[model samples]
Target: MRFEKENWDVIIVGTGPAGACLAREISKQHKKVLLLEKGQADLSINIPRMLKNNEMMFIGNGKTLVRGIRSGGTSVLYYGTAYDPPEELFSKFGIDLASEVEELRRELPLAPLKDELIGPAAQKIRESAVSLGYAWEKLDKFIYQDMCTPGYFPFDAQWNATRYVNDAINSGAVLLTNSEVTKVIVNGKQAVGVEAIVQGERHKLFASQIVLSAGGLGTAQILQASKINKAGEGFFCDPITIVQGLAEGIEAGNEIPMAAGMMFKNEGFILTDLTLPKLVYQLFSFQALRPHRVWQHRRTIGIMVKVRDGIGGSIKRGKVHKVFSEADKLKMQQGESKAREILQHAGAKRLYSTVWTSAHPGGTARIGEVVDPNLKSEYDNLYVCDCSVIPTEWGLPPTLAVLALAKRLAKHLLLRSYHRR
Candidate 1:
């Protein structure tokens, strides 16, 4: 097959937060950047489109992993939560993101929801958990508060990476949607381009620098196809489940989810008040064989229990195979117990925990192994950024951390290019 004629200075695979941020920075410097996304660029929020964008993979028994395969990636489906990267985590690997994190704080809409924005379900759960001395409070969010109203969360109010992708395009970067990269085109020890399927046709796209920011599983699949045998060895997918209950006179179906929560650092889990979308609520309730409770979504109060699961999984042939350890199961159990207590304290009844699921799947192509602290792989000019590069097991939302890493990588690439010139 023939190669694309327009060679780029940098070819970024995946338009997730990391890739979008990097493309915006590089294009702003007048670099020839190409951003490729495996999914559609449509950002409409509707049930049919959302279900089509949401892709699910079965890892273990009754445990599934879900991610949004769209131009904005999973950020389109996330709760808009923000967690600062643990400085100590990256410090050990000789990387620092303090400056990038601070810059993002100024650029992005990051703050806790106001009292009026915090829904009644969240307020009741927070009160109960605080009364029990658990430090439950409003978690920081990446939301535009001016776009929201009391007890109602607008999807457009959430800050997704698509905005950065748009900025990159306006800065002269080329964005190709519905393009799935299969592997890197390497020449001996140097990287040259990528082989991808763009709208059902195979093509080779050349670039001086190639970065694989195709998220955790997607990146690992490409590395494996490129003969990187160790890319998909082990990984973590912050396992999560929701403890749901019926609370009389509580209307929570239309409220924002994950508005308030607390972290149990020692126990390796988190508890947050969650209000699932009407469709998701019905699906989960049906999955649990509670048909009678399906119509009670408006009165359902939910607490999400997310745990730091052990890393032991592989992505082979574009499929994930993982089994949570006994310890991971125990952590979930403990978290569910605590969530149950809080729900009961808030006068909820008939509590039930949903099946285990994971949204944050990462750590496969980790730093110190598949990639260096600079996020570069063994091949020259080939870098890996995103959740896959995170060096350790992480249970928190990774958007901010990945964005910081992308910023650092962008500066490194720009400096290297300037020196070459």
Candidate 2:
């Protein structure tokens, strides 16, 4: 590939929500930006393709960590649930997401699922929880309701980071797929560029500023490789398991997962309806040694028990080392019990819990420790705007919070660029 003599204003690694939003905002301001993604640009939701793109690693204690390695990152596989960023948490660090969050609300399609759009399984579970006085409520989703229908979860109806990536592209940002960045090239105290493998070829890209949005695990590895030793010292992956039971005469399994649920803040866990796809259901069933239930996707009703786990992990030599604390186990146990009670109340039977798995891996490069309140690393012109920068144990979907942070980072970067000129 021929080299461009001019350096870009910013180079963002990863196409997840944070990177996408940042690229979109920065490009809209007419800044020269380069976006790199390690995964292919394909966004297909089929089983074979997703499995191929999803890199699953056994972190520790038999628990697995999975994240999409394709364009749009894990948001392509997420349930599109939108949770506001914890204001107090950010306020403590001298960061506030109020303006960015409000701007996002005006831009994105975010609302609770309508009654007609709620699937039978989620409805049944909600009914049971409400009957038990648990205060289960409909969750806000990033779905375009006009594009959705009853009993079916349409992929296009759900919002993902790809939308922002496309917007960024339209605004003249350049994107390079299959480019895996290895490390940032720091000159003295300032980051000047990065070294990456582009389409299996080693490529060195230069930029005035480098922002790593390569996710929790990916960013930690790159930072460590770049000589930031404290990048991945400890982390948290909010572990989750589904407590499932068979409900007779309910045509379930096609609805959106996590559509309705409640948080047990005191218990340090959350419960939500989780109707997995047929393939995923079968995979979980086989993993749990329940071959008899492998074919019960249509009749299975499940509630996900996701716990706010303590930070006790490290990203070392391309592997995740993690273990749950005793408190984490107790929280999951209590959540599972609550889920089973709801299932039983809803006329479900043969309850069983699936193996533990985690989707969000974060707290690796923490805010106060690794990154500053402005999300800047110790080196100049380097920043991190992914789940890795979240300083606390987060149990909810972090798409909204990540997007908000990206917006804030974009404003800061643009202002800094203007000041430099």
Candidate 3:
């Protein structure tokens, strides 16, 4: 592979926020970079279309968890929700991202949504939560308001990693889609390169630096497959469920989903109003055995509750062997109850819940335990800069935090390259 040449400085094994940001940043230094994505490069930013086509979305193990597998990774499916990282968490890794975080906030379109963008369902949810004494508020997002309309587009208004991928490509970085990395090629505790499968063929690519940003589960699966035996253990997947109800006199065809929510930090959960597109709404409604509610798609309002689960699981053959504990069940129950109450207060009836599923999964390869503070593993030049590096439970969206953290990792990689040269 061309990456085997001495001119190739780095190879990133993902197109998600971490890898995308890193490639874009490193390419600015005129370094030869290679970005590999396991999925296709076709942009499937239209939510309704992707839902109908049943492509780009990967739901494994009876819908236990779902993720987007595409050039932009899950960010293509994301609603751009933003949150400040628990800086203290990275402090344990002896890294401070205050400046990086601030820089990204300025660079990206992170802001609280305007009132016009807040759907009626979200307003009702916020009012109910406030009346119930919960501090409900609008969440910031990485949205370009100028391009953001209610409907979805192929290259929707979302601030996806694809933009960064494009920038990297324009800066002379090479990107290969549909190249699934199977393992990192290690030479006696030193990562010299990686081996991947492309179109059912094997290929070897050598690089001075190898950065793994293939998400949490994706990264863990790769590590375990690479003979890093302990890499897949001790993972968590914020066990979650969506409490939904049919609200009378509410129409949400053009409503932006996930705009407002109540963060019950101490209560160990969050409640967000999940507005849905009509087609997507009907599918969930039918599968939930509420086929009778299918026609009322525009009137459906949902509240999603996600709680931190104990990190204890193993990933084998790309499947997560994890289950909800008794304590996790209790937290789910508590959160579901609150969500139902808010829906009821908002004049919603015929309440129901989707089976528990995880949106974010992480902590598989931790900072202090599995990797060092520099995000380097037990092996040399093998770094991990994704959710897998998160050492503890995190209840928020990780896109923003991952992008900032990648900047820190990119700085380290660049400095190391300089010293070596």
Candidate 4:
């Protein structure tokens, strides 16, 4: 492979929350860091841009999917709902994120949306859930209220990977945009560099440490390309369905999605408010074959049933092959039933879930199997610290947990001796 002129102390792949967080942390130690991004830089993250770009959306066999392919990754286009990863799972891997999570709690804007910020439809849904004794409560978010304007500008006011990317750059990290890393280059079981295509040209970058934080699918594919065993086996993506309803008089137009929800942890599902931006609402309406409903989008109310599913999947030829188990199907049905009950209570009619789609893909390359406790892979100096490292399907957004995991990994890699293969 051809080599670049510069050598880095650490080369991080993918600029998502996990990758960005880790890069910034390492750069703070004055290391020569390089961040490689698959997508182009300077791509504005907004509803319109997302709607127009085909590359931004990676759909797998019309089942699993992910969006927001750019310098900041999906964090740039998120709805802001956040959930903490189950601590026990990480503990089993000999890692803890409590301290890091605490630090972020104080730094990031993380709180439940205020009553004034909740939309009328969602408010009614919350009331109905409370009346039914489901213990539905406000969901934590990563948004700064004062930074947000009155309208539905999805790109602005949210805490995204871009902030950390900038922080890493300011702290002396070099970033290569449009550099799609295909695989880790291992020299006789020792990973020392990566081969990537940068703006139509192939380039090889060497580093003392190589970290892959390219979400589940991206990381899995990269590992497979390097002939890593079981790259995506035993992976899972939360099965989800959005139950749409029309609130008679309430205007839920372009409100924040997943404002509040009830969690039935043991039952493995959540009934949450699912409001979309105005244009996205119309797209959903059309996809539902209800073009007539476009006029009533302002009065539209939505309830999403996001449930954890059993882990069983394979990634071959850049595609994901997975099916929902009977247990998962049962949970989806239960969630739909609960959502319908709440929508009915809110005076909403014609309740229906648009379609079944998989949530963020993860657990592809697991902690105990693909990577060790320190997130180091089988090849020396190769590490993975993204959704791909998660060992279970928690059925929650992974930013907070992923960010903390990166911080923990950075500390471990610095404080401990590297395990040479």
Which candidate wins on lDDT? 2
Lowest lDDT block of 10, candidate 3:
52-61
lDDT of each: 0.90, 0.91, 0.81, 0.81
Local accuracy of candidate 4 as per-residue lDDT tens digits, 1-421: 2338778889999998899998899998888899999887754645556646533343444453545568888787677878887888788777778899998888788998877777777888889888987788999989886765444435566788889999999999989887889989999989989999987898888998999998888899999999896778867777777888877767667666788998888889877898867676776677668788878777788888988888886777776677677898899999899999988887888876775666567898898889888888899889999888888776878899999989888887766433432
Give residue 392's lDDT in candidate 2 (0 to 100): 86
RMSD in angstroms between candidate 4 and the native structure over all alpha carbons: 2.7
Misplaced by over 4 Å in model 3 are 1-7, 45-63, 149-155
Error of 3 at 31 (Å): 0.9
lDDT of 2 by residue, 1-421 (tens): 7533558999999999999999999999999899999998877666666556556778877788888787898898888999899898899999999999999999999999999999999999999999999989999899999987898677899999999999999999999999999999999999999999989999888898899999999999999999999999888888989999999989998988888999998889989999998888998998899999998899999999999999887789887888888999999999999999999999999999999999879898999999998899989999999999999899888999999999999999999999999
How do the residues 1-421 of candidate 3 rate in per-residue lDDT, one tens digit apiece? Answer: 5444444689899998889999999999989899988888866456555554333233444555656667888787777888888878788667898999998988898897787777778888988988988878899978887775444322456688999999999999999888889999999999988888865678888888999989888898888877877787877777667888878787765677788887777767777888766666776666677788888777778898888777876777865677667887788899999999999998898899977667667888888888888899988999999888988877778888889889999999999999997
Once model 4 is optimally superposed onto the true structure by TM-score, how far is the C-alpha of residue 34 displaced, in angstroms?
0.6
From the highest lDDT down, the ranking of the candidates is 2, 1, 3, 4
TM-score of each: 0.97, 0.98, 0.93, 0.93
Q: For model 1, how big is the CA root-mean-square deviation?
A: 1.5
Candidate 1: give the clashing pairs. none
